[model samples]
Target chain A: MSNITSQRSAPFVVAQIRQDFPILKLKVNDKPLIYLDNAASSQMPQQVIQRLVDYQTNEHANINRGVHYLSETATLRFEEARGKVQRFINAAETREIIFTSGCTESINLVMHGYGRKFIQAGDEIILTVLEHHSNIVPWQMLAEEKGAIIRVVPINDAGELLIDEYQKLFNPRTKFVAISHVSNSLGTVNPIREMIKFAHGHKVPVLVDGAQAVPHMSVDVQDLDCDFYAFSGHKLGGPTGIGILYGKASLLEAMQPFKGGGDMIAVVSFAKTTYNHIPHKFEAGTPPIAAAIGLGAAIDYLLQIGMVAIAEHEHQLLEYATAQITKLAGVTIIGRAKNKVAVISFVVADIHPHDVGTLLNLDGIAVRTGHHCTQPLMHRLGLSATSRASFAMYNTFAEVDALVAGIVAVQQVFAGSM
Target chain B: MSNYKDLYQEVILDHNKKPRNYGQIEKATHQAAGHNPLCGDHLQIALELNQDLICAIGFSGESCAICKASASMMTVAVKNKTRADAEALIQEFLALAKGQLNAIDLIQIGRLAVFAGISQLPTRVKCAILPWHTLHAALNSGAETSTEAEHDPMRTTIGGA
Candidate 1:
């Protein structure tokens, strides 16, 4: 609480948070690292790091297997972490949460398992132009394999999905509607709840890629009634190589297991192999135990600060950055959606995004440049790529000011030469 | 913010703004396109060779400052040099950009030294190397190669020669 207040007052709270991540303290060209590429991955907090260290040191046992005390203790902690994630996203049951390597694996799990079992030839999978390649490529592969067609919901010049166009893309053949809750490239907070409900009306299953959204807002999978919700831990102040895939229990019971292995099955006889129930059925082999514990710690950290407060703080930062950067000449923000998370993608007129990113780095300000793993969106926007500044709870308004100053420097450097 | 000034030197920005030989070359004998799909950087390097010595070199595409400037400087550096010299320069420049070498004495190659700062950014190494990678590919393909560079390592695997 006090930490959050102190964090709000400073423009460079990320530098403080950077100290919590031991790697962030490392000098890059004798300059303090200003990591603004939260969308790619976030710096892990000290709590999360400690949690991983403690888990491996003290609770280093395989879960749900051995009858020994260590095994039982490990199982309890793992399941407890699952429960925390269930609560974090407000999912109906712990069984709905399946841990994976990351968001890409989670999306692949859904696309390969559920998509293979349900989708038929000629069926349409409705996606948006604004999805990250992780969300789009798996479905594209599934569609190609299943003889299904993909129908994309177009976005406006502002990068907001055209709701009316999305509605039109819907039909009986639209078996699944997979969309990102927030655009990784554009930072548009899509009306996913409404979109999910509309898809439900047509009896279409909807999978929400909450990788970007879950870190920024309060996500209630049950309330949204989305068929599936997926996110990565690294984006939310947790360790890498860990993610959550939340499916409705009913759907989980129906879908086939994505990978076959020891933990995912009940009995493995030569004659017949019985699979495990719900969550375990999808979690094959030895899971990322330390990373899961780190995610739990990250969730605990966020809960202690409160998601509402974090969201409010981020919204303020986004507003400040947007207002300031928009004032710069030749700067055109890609997405101007009414509702959005903390990402802002823009291009400074003749200056390329990579150039903007490079120049900004000199100011100890980090940002993502180029298409942001959203090449289709770049094609839709009719641009090569845009520089993106994504915010997290630790990010501050002063960092936003630094970003503006960096852009101004870029303008001067290029303008003088021109 | 303190001393990273070398990373964004004035010369790099100058070249980025007013790029040299930025358009397509007419009747290019060899050409290759390179794309950094990660950053959406697309560059087409065109070479006009008269026998062994390079007669003209041109490029056309959109990319970041490091890549565009590198490409701009590369075109100027390779012009009138032997094909083998151009290939060797590409290797030297690649090594220099990676900071494997302290300094590269390529006659008049200047400001390219600024990209030495890019090696400090592990993620951006691809953005800096894209044009050179493309030039390498175009030279290897042996096709009448036009408008296509070798396959980008960032996008595709480079197969056996």
Candidate 2:
């Protein structure tokens, strides 16, 4: 529960949280692992892991089926998890939450369930340059299928979206807006609530990709009024293969079912078929029951520790890391957005990010190095790739120090040869 | 994983710093580009062949040290050698980098043997072998971007880079 409130705070509660994640103690290359790839996927805590073990141990059964004890119990637990997600994001109702495989699938679901149903030829879908491929590609597929035009909102030099350009892109033909809550590559936190409000002003439904944001800060779908909010469970310290898509009740009711299966339909026959209600209509086949329950446990863990504390600790890490990395010569940190998560992406002199990442691994540091599935953003920045070190609540300042030293060592390795 | 010391030895680093024949050749007899979409690596290989002998060879690209070094060493290894020799060496070098060669082939590889560590670094195998892929493409007038079906290890796996 103790978040590092100050820079170099000696007493920290994060150390206790780190104890809850067994993987943090692992060593690589004869050194303690410095996992800075949290943006890629956050590690699971013991609480969530144990929840999975308990579920598989006793509550194993196919949900939404037989009247057997295990089946009913499993179905109850699954619905309970959905309720937890409803409360977690402040969704208006549990029926509005549809479980998917991941954030990508959630976005694809909206594209299939809502987009395919509404979008038409010549309709313009507004997106942003900072969006990960997950957000962009699905819309592109929809546009390609429907002959809809896709317009992108440009970003400023510091990686902040040009709000003017965003609003300018909105017009009578603009039908949908999809934006990320946080930039996976740069850590830029877009003002989703304001952006959603602007989209709503045009009466265009917006989908907020909160996969990167939810892990760092608190999110309220009702407050944002975003028609659809999607995130991956893995990014939120839960198991993979499970995610939640929170859609407005009216929107959920209006959209078509994303997939066809036994649970999604009330009745089926060769002659005619009738679909089921809202959530079940969207959740098609057998869902990832264990992962859903585990995500609920993760929410409990986060609620117990508190998001404000998590955000505060991660911000301090970002501040300290930025200051430390900025002091190093021949290093340039990309994405200097005024508002950001605890992700620092940078370049070392002229060294390729792949090289920097490899050398860092020698010191047991794990950082992501690539376009980060944001190729369009990379094109806009005029860089092929960057090295990104993303912090989680479990990360410590000492790990940040290790990352800096690792970078320095990497530079030395290349510099000596040069 | 191979130690960084072995993976990026002096020869590899020296070539990366001052790569030999690190530029395009005008009116080259053959040319091609290699791309690793996973990590955004690119390199152009151009060679001039006259009467079954490689008279000139050059390359240029934005890639990691392993790739650049391999390209640099490849040009030095094959230049002025016969077309048959260069093509045979290319086969040997590819096998060596993939760790598919025997002791005799390793010895036959000579200076190009530095990339043997690439086989152990699964994530970086593309970076080390990309140049040869381009060279193979250039010699055969193959596609503009010779990915060698890179497998893009990054694509098959999820989580982390």
Candidate 3:
């Protein structure tokens, strides 16, 4: 193993990694902040934050369609960030990267542009039960408008997708297959490469929602051979209000523009309007310039640290967390897939998830408690909500220990009263 | 991070553990359901009234500690109080939750005062207020005066005086 990988594998060194995130320096309720809610959004690194500050102070101007010095500088920085994203996801070309508000808007762009045009009446779009609302709702809207059929692939008790069932859902009418690369509610890391191949066999395009996956693992769109990949910047140590939608160049050119405004149009007249080319055709109006720059910095930071090392570190943390949390009484870990991300959701017996969350907060530990924007997934699991603790590279094994200790405290408090 | 440890006082924990009137009341006079979709906390509160006073209050649903305990304490606090008084108490609770009042007024509500700590958590404020919101809906739905049982609080009739 590499030195970083070896160092990460050691639990003690993992404990020390907590210092990297500046937010961990503060105290909550006189206790050190033990943030375990990385799946929702990650805390910004000093580097990422500084990048945003530098952009606002030094290079703040609208990108593209400009010739002045500041505009030229801003445009160069913006395109450089796009190039960074192109490398981060291993897309074939820089033109494949289109920036948007976040994962929701990214998915909506595809649904409205590509899905609206291709998905006709009686056409079918297949998705899994593990999708967040962002993935489910946009498709539902498109299906309803186009009179397309929506098919959901069910998950097993362990939260892993039933590949056989997913295949069964595939038909000649299956125009698209939308799936989350890693489930946000459960930590199940889907076999996306095989899934992409399966969809392509049916001649159907696939959109992989990588909001949870991109943060934890190395993603290569070329390797997966997915038609489109989407992820939120905020979930990956970058600023909010920025996300990327990577599509095949040909497919992007074929699709219509999702929104019509400045920057996305090449020419506008009362007589005729001509849309811009490729990526800019999809991005509308004053885009999140500073956020895009911050995302670039975040990508740089992750590349420097190496995603493979981060994945390995998270794997060790997941193993250790699973072992410790499962040992606690009345605590049932939600998902147990063979391959998964670092997100873990669980319910303490007879205790509502919010209660578990509040009690844990008393100890200065932050966790998400709810349906995790996947109500259908919760319904599939016969649960209303589950408390979730997702990990990032900056998280420490000591934070996991603190989580265990906090959960134990909840169990003790509720157990005595009951 | 504030010195709000008293918000999780033993009485609140006790009420949360062995919540009184914590089952569905058959043929309830007034029923209302409240939900905090953000956290997925759902609560259904049923009130049995005699004349203008609340005879009994029972609630059945699931939620977190702050919500469940608040509901449980609410049942005990509002029993036998006039509808107007109950409404006033709800308003007081809302103000306290918004940090407009001190912990002393919250302490007046006994164990329910433990939720004063939740006021510090902006996100969790909704979870603690689920029961109050449901009660408000139930009362406004003509459940206060009508002796007839209602099926779903979400669909309850309103504006009947």
- Sequence-dependent TM-score of model 3: 0.91
Give DockQ: model 1: 0.50
Model 2: DockQ vs. true structure: 0.59
Evaluate residue A60 in candidate 2 and report its C-alpha lDDT on the 0 to 100 scale: 84
The residue-by-residue lDDT of candidate 3 on A1-418, one tens digit each, is 1322322333334445555578879888678888899999998888898899999999989888688988999999999999999988889999999999999999999999999888899999999999999999999999889899999999999999999999999877888999999999999999999999988988999999999998888788998999999999999899999999999999999999999999899999999999999899998799999999999999887776777878888898899999999998889999999999898899999888877787788889999988889999999999989999999888877888999988888777766742
- Residue B106 CA error for candidate 1 (Å)? 6.4
lDDT of 1 by residue, A1-418 (tens): 2222332333334445545667666555466666679888987778888888888888979888699988888888989999989988888789999999999999999987899999999999999999999988998899889899999999888778899999998877889999999999889999999999999989999999999998887788878999999999999998899999999999889998999997999999999999999899999999988889789999887776667777888899899999998898889988999999998889888778877887777667788877788888889888878888888877767778878877898787776642
CA-only RMSD, every prediction: 4.4, 3.5, 5.0
Question: In order of the candidates, what TM-score does chain B achieve?
Answer: 0.79, 0.84, 0.79
Q: How many clashes in each structure?
A: 4, 0, 3
Residue A180 lDDT in candidate 3:
94
What candidate 2 gets wrong by more than 4 Å, as runs, is A1-12, B102-107, B148-161
lDDT of 2 by residue, B1-161 (tens): 65446758574458988999988787699888888888888888899989878889999878888888888998998899887887788778767766777536554578676677677677877677777777777887765654445432212221114
TM-score of 1: 0.89
- C-alpha RMSD between model 2 and the true structure: 3.5
By TM-score, the candidates rank as: 2, 3, 1
